[model samples]
Target: MEPGATLLNSTLQQTDASVSLLWTLTLVPLSGETPRKGPATMPLFGKSHKNPADIVRTLKENMAILVKQDKKTDKASEEVSKCLVAMKEILYGTGDKEPHTETVAQLAQELYNSGLLISLVENLQVIDFEGKKDVCQIFNNILRRQIGTRSPTVEYFSSHQEVLFVLQKGYETPGSALNCGIMLRECIRHEPLAKVVLHSEHFQDFFNYVEMETFDIASDAFATFKDLLTRHKVLVAEYLEQNYDAIFDQYEKLLHSENYVTKRQSLKLLGELLLDRHNFTVMTRYISKPENLKLMMNLLRDKSPNIQFEAFHVFKVFVANPNKTQPIIDILLKNQTKLIDFLSNFQKDRSDDEQFNDEKTYLVKQIRDLKKPAS
Candidate 1:
């Protein structure tokens, strides 16, 4: 053979050998065949596999080559999509004569661990609601184990990019919404995910889920849910302006709940929603009521520091406003002891952080001013 032709043949043989190895490793378990542990046996087309570790190492190396080569080819991403589709079908579709649950589960875990599943989910955009719903079902089943069984899955899915997909796609169906609620509830138990999810566009979808009946299953869904509520001040302000009556009705009902945590969360959400210029007129009606002030005064003594802080902050804001200042003054005269105690505790426990110290100083100044001699 000519030297050039000989070189081309050798290259083709190596390519074929690598491709064969990938196919064998990826499909052998599904085929119920114990993996073979040596070279291809064909001359000039063999790839030695020294051991199980060697097989894995060779498989990873070949996968990288395949990905690189695919990247160079026209429509390589399309080909990859097709491969993913075929893999999904084999794992999720029922058309196969007999599905290998163990192999499929292993592949799902491997994909999740490598972050390929998350990447695939990010790339996914289905215009068809039904198709989106089906994908969500599969994703939910795969992630359910992670959400319920493993602790890390909560953090993993709470990633901004990952939860963004859930927010964008999970609202397609009621079932998907429930799945997202479950995931978010687990995520909020940890601070990192909670912080990310609270500020994300996903938060709107989260509120939507809470508005629906599915919220009953995850009561702690809003345990510290109030903290996130304060972050979206503008959005909450807008929502309250348009939905004040509905919100007030729900707030009233929530206050009667046996779960003090939920009640405090509702109050905090209400406070955030009402802490805007637009809602000021309507909020005055609630804040000025003697009974409402008493309720807030009671809340100031709640065991949860968050509830105490939020109640005092809301009271301060309401009293600072020109329209509600007199009613607030009246309440303060009636509950001077409680107000003094709260201010003293707040100042004593205040952190040295400049911002917190500034707030503490401002509160003390406000309290001093409130006790000024009458003209």
Candidate 2:
């Protein structure tokens, strides 16, 4: 045999010995000895071959076993979590040398082929928060590899769209909400899956999620909610054009919500959506509505400066429109004095914001320049 083959054989044997020692450590608690205080680090590659292919195969087999466990028990769930953590280490390995990309792609394909992706979504409803986060990280890694590949990802998800809905429904459970919202956002990076989510009747449920009493869960859900609305520009624009009235009605209610955070964040995201060039049609239609302007006008007087600031961005869009619709112009004409008074004092703390100051001056001048309607 060649000298290189001999060295590889020696390395494999040593790796096998390390894995054997690790396995012995695992069985020690079962043998009634005191358990280790913390988890022992497990190398990603092991067995007689000790190579990337071996690591991928081992991770797949171990994950298959883990997914079959009754995830309700703490012991079982913890073990499953450990298994996922190890798989994550293999796929997202750390060292001076980056983990082999081809090896990780193979492992990702193995997870999908082994049907563990489906199992992860199913088990998410029962797993602990850390476990759920690990599961989401795995999906994030897998999709990052598969982003532009002309592969079966879309087909796989399209066939199992319920998995997407399951992640969405996860928001209903506070324990799972944050992680599952994270997973949902990662999944939404695919336009096909995003479309499914956007058109689903339950899409309305996010309004409730952003307003939930649990602060962390509500904030996390809002993060996903923003991704859903903003990630796919064309899809969002089309959805807005089709569902404008119903959807904006819910958003209008959000703008008026008593919760300050809810109102503030909704205004911020609204500005982002309207400012995106792809939503030009949506922005124009939204600004032309006098009621929409009225809602923003109330936001301008909000007690919170942050709300007033965000509302100003959206408010400027209406003011900057050269061809204002009759109803929109009518409202502006009626509220000219109130808007002038408010803009004069708005975001005063942002005096250093030259552009904001400039915009404020422009809005004041524009509102002042509006001609009074003929009697």
Candidate 3:
């Protein structure tokens, strides 16, 4: 049987036996085209039918059951999607003009809190960046309305640290990150609890995990992180000042680590950290050392294209500064022949059609033209 029908049947079984009988009798004629009598006057000996409290309780009970069953089934996601579509229709005042009023808002919260909606988002495997964006839009719409006397949606978001982590870890979808960030941003904007959570060790761990695992940080992850940093730039600046040596030590360890992929990710993050104006002086001092320059130069021939690309960009940045430019230039001049060969091979193997290829070719040409005569 279909899930909705099964749920309705279960609800009927749990309802008052007399109410069930009345519903059945009323619907019997519709099945067989035979006339049947509806419920007549009820006995006054039992509970009264006009109790508003009982009616509201029954509706809430049925809605809870529907929600629970919806969560247990894999089809729960499909139903939630359907509900979202229905909610959107209601929002636009286009479909089923039945006034859900506050009921729809309650239903949306119930679904979100029950983990059904999050599961749907997590299980999405297709690369529909735009669709995930639309889902975020719907979530934002539902979140905007005051559902009752409770605090706004941002309050719920601020308190639900675990939920945020699940969304970040499970979705791993780039498009969803912006919404997740926006949700976090609102928490910081409106709720004081957000400050504590954002600075928590757990939150930092989550950020590190996302940075390590996510492939295209430039799209969603980068934007979100940038927003976060921009919002809390002063705090970040202070943190870096206090932890500069430790962070550099960690980076040095990562550079010598066995896990090439993780090492590359660490290097990429380091490059980003270096790009920060607050960290510029410290990063330049570290990179200007001959030992560090040679180490980075060695990475120019690293096996991974990502690592090599990042190293190249970092080198370019380092060379942009007058203090560090001479050392970088001297290193490049020393390895001109090897660098030329590597660039030529890199150009020929560039099958990914990334826009960076032309930029890299241009840089290689500039390097060749700048090569000095042999001593």
Clashes of each: 0, 0, 0
Question: For model 3, which pairs clash?
Answer: none
* Model 3 lDDT tens row, 1-375: 356754554454345566746755655456658787765543321332213233233333433444466544444334334444444544443322453566555555565556444443444333144435545665555556564655555566566556556555533445455556555444444334444544555444443543445554323444444444445645666555665666566457666545566567557766776777876666666777666677776777788777887777666554445454566678778877887787667635665766657656765776676656468
lDDT of 2 at 213: 93
Across residues 78-195, which tens digit of lDDT does each residue of candidate 1 receive?
3343344334444564332354566555656565556654543443342123433444554554554443445445445665356544544544454344444444444445555555
TM-score: the better of candidates 1 and 2? 2
lDDT of each: 0.52, 0.78, 0.54
Instruction: Output the TM-score of candidate 2.
Output: 0.77
- How does candidate 3 fare on TM-score? 0.45
Top lDDT hit = 2
Query: Which of candidates 1 and 3 reaches a greater lDDT?
Result: 3
lDDT of 1: 0.52
- Which lDDT tens digits does candidate 2 get at residues 76-180? 655566566656765776433366677676766767677777767766756666767788888777765654666456667787798889889888876777778
Candidate numbers, best TM-score first, in rank order: 2, 3, 1
Alpha carbon deviation, residue 166, candidate 1 (Å): 16
